[model samples]
Target: MTSWILGLTGGIGSGKSAAAAHFSTLGVHTVDADHAARWVVEPGRPALAEIARHFGDEVLQADGQLDRAALRARIFQDPAQRHWLEGLLHPLINQELLANLAGAESPYAILVSPLLIESGQHTMTTRVLVIDAPETVQVQRALQRDQVSEAQIQAILQAQASRDERLRHADDVLTNDRDLNWLQTEVERLHRFYLSLRGGRP
Candidate 1:
């Protein structure tokens, strides 16, 4: 709770998870907004109830679990639906993120969120670190990593904060457009930088 907070963000497929993994290896107290978002809407949760009420039972699977893919498709296609879903979830997710941050046990903690900029999660941190990559790279990475097509990926890109906007808000940027080794080196360099900022040696 007394540690510095680092808000780490990037657009979808910008290697946010990979960056988070590197930070984890360095013992950074890390909390993922995506994980928190999913956590807040688990099957028996009140957020799930609200989601079901707004999107209907078809949004749930036969096992009575929220069908994430179906909901993603719906929200991307309907701006109003997406807005409603965000309005219902962001507050709950924030609460979970704050709780996690408060429980962090490190010189600093990293809040990894894809929507850190778009959703104003950066306000909760002392600095913002963005993982940067080209737009085409992002689309290709998403196509390979996720079960979605180009169109769906494009829809997500359209809905997220742009590369420029994200960079504009970044206090630091970790470029992930090259090989994994390069990314790791960059991350380690930043990790040390963060430690130095905290008046410690990594």
Candidate 2:
């Protein structure tokens, strides 16, 4: 039987990781799309070889691993390149994501992706949980956490769906502007709520 899936998403620095981590501690299996994305492009993977073929060897590091930052910069600068890369990678990433989610032992699993809605992965989920914060908060946290330049962060923000769009599609919203304790409380509350939605199935 398919495990119920909760699609978790948020813009950059919106605390999706922290929320998913808390869910993990509660024995919920979680599959992260970003992790799947990386796995598909690992050294020796067919996707990496294709990437090298398309973008040249410079996109690979001395160790033959993908130079992610270089690829990120290039895709962000060129819409055509970004679309081409996504077309190449998204199917592979989705396949891995579904395989992992299908193998989950928990009653429900969380599929966390920054682009859950935009990428149409939400269709696989039984519920959509959106983590949210003000854009200012998101920018400041991203700057401190990732150390990327503001312009790059702004470009990423522009590339993602707007906050309003995410909210419009959300089945649940967790505002993460406060401390971790508050976040934990909300996660716990939502955990119970999700479990209850299963009608007491163990």
Candidate 3:
């Protein structure tokens, strides 16, 4: 049977996780690309070995895991490095992500990725759902949750598709600049809409 996949995406700190959690509460099977990305870089993974070889051992922590911050800094500063890294990991991550989605038993599945559009993962879905928030809100939220400076956060945003660009690609959009209650309501509404698209009725 064919399952309708929803590509749920948003900029960093745009509350994509929170929106996905609500869908989970409503029984949606959700897969996160970030989790798949990390899985591909586990200590013994071939991808990790290649990354260490190219970027040097400094990109790995003493614990032998990927030093995400250091690696993040390296790739962002060099376009060639960023392109190389994405070329290496995107296939690995996409393979595992598609496998996971195929195994899902739910009537539909949600794939959440910050780079869903940019990484070409959006093509895997029949619908694209974008969780949007103001740039000011994104900056504030990232400052509160991560250790990065405002400048660093700005740099990350620069690397992502512009807010308008993301919206233009979306089949649906949810504004996440408000409180959880408001976000939850939008999620629930979308949840039912997706459920209606399924073969079974709820």
Candidate 4:
């Protein structure tokens, strides 16, 4: 049977996780690309060994797991390195994402990825939902949530698709510059809308 997949994405710190979690509360199964990305590079994974071989053991923590922050800094500063890393890991992550999504039993499943549009993952979905917040808000939120420097956050923002570009491709947009109550209400409204698209499944 065909699954109705919703592609959910947004800029870093745009409340995508919170929105997805709320959707979970309503029984929507959500698969996260970030989680898949990490899964592909777990300590025992071939991808992790390849990364260490290419970038040296510096990219690995003493415990043998990927040093995500070190690797993030390395790639963000070099476009060629970033491309190489993406080339290596994107396919693996995609495979895992597809498997998890295919197993979803919900009437409609959500694939949450910060790079959903950029990585072409949206092609797998029936609809694209963008959780949007202003750039300033994004920066502030990221600053509060991560231990990274402002410069590092700026680099990440630069690497991602521009805000307008995401909106241009979005089938639905959830503006997240507001409070949690507003977000929950919007999620419920969209949840109903998505169910209706599936003939209003209970």
- Encode model 1's per-residue lDDT on 26-120: one tens digit a residue: 88989999999989989899999888998899899998889998898898889999998899899899999999899988888999999998888
Question: Which segments of model 4 are wrong by more than 4 Å?
Answer: 199-202
| Candidate 3 residue runs with Cα over 4 Å from true position | 198-202
Of 2 and 3, the candidate ranking higher by TM-score: 2
Question: Model 1: residues >4 Å from true position, as ranges?
Answer: 199-202
- Structural similarity to truth (TM-score) of each candidate: 0.95, 0.96, 0.95, 0.95
Which pairs clash inside model 4?
none
lDDT of 2 at 106: 85
Clashing pairs for model 1 are: none
| TM-score (C-alpha, index-matched) for candidate 3 | 0.95
Each candidate: what lDDT? 0.89, 0.92, 0.91, 0.91
The most accurate candidate by lDDT is 2
lDDT string for model 4 (1-202, tens) is 3358899999998999999999999999999999999899998899999999999999988999888889988998899999999999999999999999888898889999999988889888888899999999999999999988899889988899899999998989999999999999999999888888853232
Model 3 over residues 1-202: C-alpha lDDT tens digits? 3377899999989999999999988888899999999999999999999999999999999999999989999988998999999999999999999998998778888899999989999988888899999989999999999978998999999889889888988989998988999999999998878878754232
TM-score of 2: 0.96
